[model samples]
Target: MATLSEIETWLHDRLPALLAEYEVPGAAVGVSFGGEVIDHAAGVLSKATGVEATADSVFQIGSITKVWTTTLVMQLVDEGKVELDAPLRDYLTEFVLADDAAAAEITVRQLLSHTSGFEGDIFNETGKGDDAVEKYLATLAEVTQLFPPGEMFSYNNAAFTVLGRLIEVLRDKPFDACLREYLFTPLGLKHAATDPYEAILHRAAVGHIRPTPEAEPVPAPVWALNRSMAAAGAMLAMQPRDLLAFAQLHLDSGKAADGTQVLSAASVEAMQEPQVKVPALGLMGDSWGLGWELFDWAGTKVIGHDGGTIGQGAFLRVVPEHGLAVTLLTNGGDLIDLYRTVVGHVVKELAGLELPALPTPPAAPVQVEVDRFLGTYSCEVADVTIRQDEDGKVWLDQTPKGIFAELGAKPEPVELVGRDEQSLIALKPENGFHSPHVFLGDDGTGRALYIHSGRAMRRAPA
Candidate 1:
């Protein structure tokens, strides 16, 4: 591990230029290694306000909040109050789905691992009340199930909302209160908060969205996601430092800095162990753990998660064996590029580890037989259609659903190239990064495309 002075020196020398190269408005980073920590922040928090960023400036850590949610669930497991294998209906009696049989079989483990296989993206506002998650659960009664329970890996935000409700029921308190009492307060995270109302009490960064590649990013139209989706990725806010401190607990076997046991050592290990294989979606992790994404970088195990919300992006990566964790929180601009540059440097410098290289496209592209994947594939918040043109060029038409569609959204057609017999990559013409659109083989049930962050978009009935 690099010394604190060395890490600070590297950040001062390297970060600003990289941020400028990526056009990132602002970013904060935290590195924890060998029981030492260093934090760095750069650029303005918002282009409009011109507020300088600081290490203490809280950015919505987006889906990075999933690990925290899962930590609370594991704490309940430690108390013998919750069982990972038990059906979720065992806890939330009001839980129902369009597919009743599958709903009855979904387990707590599946929810944590994102294998619940239901329509994942439901962003209905349930109002910011104690009953928010309850109302969210009620709305799922009409949502469709994309896969049978535990059948395959599909990123599901709705699953976490369900888990959020379970937490409310099990703790007999609101989700935010339970988070404060069980995780944030116990860990002494002074600035950590679960909703915008609480986050505004701290130095919070506003999200920004760019209209085009050359356009300047402006404040995002939406301030925060619906409270109903809080557990999934709605409202958690914290600085990179506190986020790293939380990761340190996992590295310390669930023991806080003061030697307080927050989660059992066994539960912590289970949370990092590989639970199910994840489809390739340009993510670093090859598999999903209880809540963490498990990555194998040159045969060394790394665990962490990435989060995005309203143009804000956050990444947390932990090298448990090396006692190292690094986080990057940014408000806008080519986030994936910034993450690759910043986080790629941190791992290589501090831990003697190289992050995964971006996947290269095929040397010779092959046209796909569009008919096989031609049907409409639907999920909770989006539908994707595979189409072929007169020249036999295959592509995918992705259309947002629900609230997004109501706001004048339109389908985006991304060109596809065959990576293999069963897999295709949606090539973003500008960057050429390969986002895998793999076809999970039909097994009598139906054919499906694992798109939208590896969520299964099953073909509609013929």
Candidate 2:
């Protein structure tokens, strides 16, 4: 393992090149091991303002906040105020879905595991107030149930929103206040905030977006997600060190730095226990736990989560056996690429673990009959269509659904080059990144099964 000085030198030298390479506006990184923490920041907070980024500058940590919310729920569990297996309705009596039966049957476990089988991405704008979460839950009555409760595993933002509401109801305060009291304050995370109003009080980074393939990224108009989605990872912003402090609680067996039991060790273990097999198709992690993505990195068990909102992205990973964790919080740019370089280097240097390789295409592209996949496969968030033109080249076209469609999101058309009977990667020029697309099989009823980023989308009926 490299010495601390070596790691610090490497970061200082390498991060600027990465920020430029990825077109990222700015980023902050934190690494913790052996009672020492290394936090660093680079690039400008925004290209427009030219504000230099700092280790103390806050950026939305996105869905990484879900684990924090999960920790809050687990605290309630430690106090016997919530049950993992209990129906969500037991605590959130106001919760109802388009499918009344599903509303009655969905358990807190299912929600935590992303197995609730409900159309999860309900980004309906609930007004900013203490009652925002309550109003959001009421809006669920309009959302269609994607499947019966607990029948399949699909990422569900709405489920976490409900979990956020659960915290508010049980704690008798707003979700933001509850987060501060139950987790942030006890851990002394002064730089962390859960809403835009609070975030404005700090040196928070502005989100950015690349308008086109060749244009420079500009500042995003909307800085935060709809207030209703805050619990599902919309609102929380923090510096990298503050994020590591939160991760430290998990690495320390759920005990705070002051030796207070913030979460029972049993509850912590349960959070790491595998709950559902994620559909990464050989990329990312193999499964999902309560609020964590479980990875088998070089035979070591690593638990972590990645979050994205607007154009910002954040990542948190923990190697508990080594008492090591690494985080990346970025406002924009090629985040996945930045993560692979930074996180990969740190883990290899400190913990002797190599990060997963990015997906690559085979030297010779394979060809297959394209009619088999010539249909639409969809989930709540998006839909993808596979088709073959008269020239006989297969293409995959993907677009947003539900809330995303309502917001007028655009579709990306990728040229699909087959890798096998079951898999392919979007064929781009050598300079472009190749993302894998796999056909999982048939989902019965004569519909083709497809997996993208660990979420299953089946053929949609005409």
Candidate 3:
């Protein structure tokens, strides 16, 4: 295992590489191991002012807030105030869906596991009243279901919004307040508030967006979603060390820094158990827990989650077996792959184990007949024309530039890393896609049909 000093040096050296490569403003990292935290910060917090990053600089954690929501729900379960499998409508009368029957069958557990089959990003609150949650729930009569309940994992943000509403109803308080009282305060997370924008204005790191390859950066607006959406992505600014404290609590069997048992051991374990299968997300061997993702990293089990805001990214990974937790908070749009890389490197060095690399697609042959795969495959989302290049190498012609970059070069006998009937995986480097690309096609031409947002694509004709 790497020494603490060595790990710190590696972080200092590698973070600049990521910043230079991605052009992000700055990043803060915190790692907890053996009951202590090693916190580090580097680069500029605001590129405009050249303000150096610090460990206390609060960063928006985006969807990493889901863990707090899940923890609150599990706490309610511990108190017998809520049942995981009980229909959510039982607690919130306003809960309903476009499909009345399916909505009635949706359970609390399904929302946390993202298996309610609710459409992702279906609820639009633009121009709505301040009470967006109430307005949206009232409009559920018009909302539609993407799939049936428990059918598969769909990563529905709306479902989590409903979960936040459920929390408000059961607690008789705003969802944010419930999170603060039951989760944040009890855990001694003083620097980890849901609304750090107002709480720590001077020290808060404002999100910035770089519009073009060569353009001035602009401050991104802070999102003001209704508390109903809190479960999906509401929590705000947090210092890296503060986040490490939260991780340590979980590592210490849900005991807070002051040694108070904020959450029962059973509840923590329940949050780590895989409740649903998410094969579509390259997680065939993994499962979605209450609020965490459970997967095998090397031979060790990893329970963690990733988060993204409109212009920021955050990731929290915890290895229970090794009592190690890593948190990365960045104020930029495309830092997820960097977060994963940092985590993998730190874990490898600290635990003396190598993490698994992402699967690579098979290589294309230098020479081969290209007529069998020649066709203009069209899908509902994209049109892909597979043609033979001048070098006789088959390539996916007419592919969107964004999608093509994600797919990389064409390959023969493309391996399916992930698939469903509607989509297929082509080739994705271990780092993952810069922008989401959807795969649309069959196994004959290629499992992937087209490249849409969040999926991979490849050329099949040559």
Q: Best by TM-score, which number?
A: 1
Candidate 2 residue-pair clash tally: 1
lDDT of 2 by residue, 192-230 (tens): 988888888888899887665566778877888888888
Relative to the true structure, how large is the alpha-carbon lDDT of every model? 0.83, 0.84, 0.66
Consecutive 10-residue window with the lowest summed lDDT within model 3: 411-420
Candidate 2 — worst ten consecutive residues by lDDT sum? 445-454
List candidate 3 stretches off by more than 4 Å: 126-132, 196-202, 213-218, 221-228, 280-285, 359-361, 365-462
Residues 1-462 of candidate 3 have per-residue lDDT tens digits of: 787778888887788777767666888899888877787877676666778888887787877787777888888898899999999888887887778898899999988888886555543442333355555666566666655798666566677777777777788877767877987787667576566445465466666665542454455554334344556885456888877777777788888988888888998988888887655344223678888887776668987777766456788888888888888988774474676578878888888656555433436422322353455653222346555567654444443332222323232332222233333344544225411123434446433433433212233343
TM-score of each: 0.95, 0.94, 0.79
Q: Candidate 1 — which residues are off by over 4 angstroms?
A: 366-368, 406-412, 429-432, 443-453
Q: Candidate 1's residue-wise lDDT over 1-462, tens digit each? A: 567678888888888887788878899999998898899999878887888889999999999889999999999999999999999888888999999999999999999998887888888788989899999988988888876788888888888989899999999999899988988876888778788788888878888876654577677877678889988889899988789889999999999888899999999999998889987666658999999999999999999999988878899999988888999999988787888877888788778898787665678876655566666777767778888789978788878887766644564587887876667776663322567777876636444444434777776665
**Of the pair 1 and 3, which is ahead by lDDT?**
1
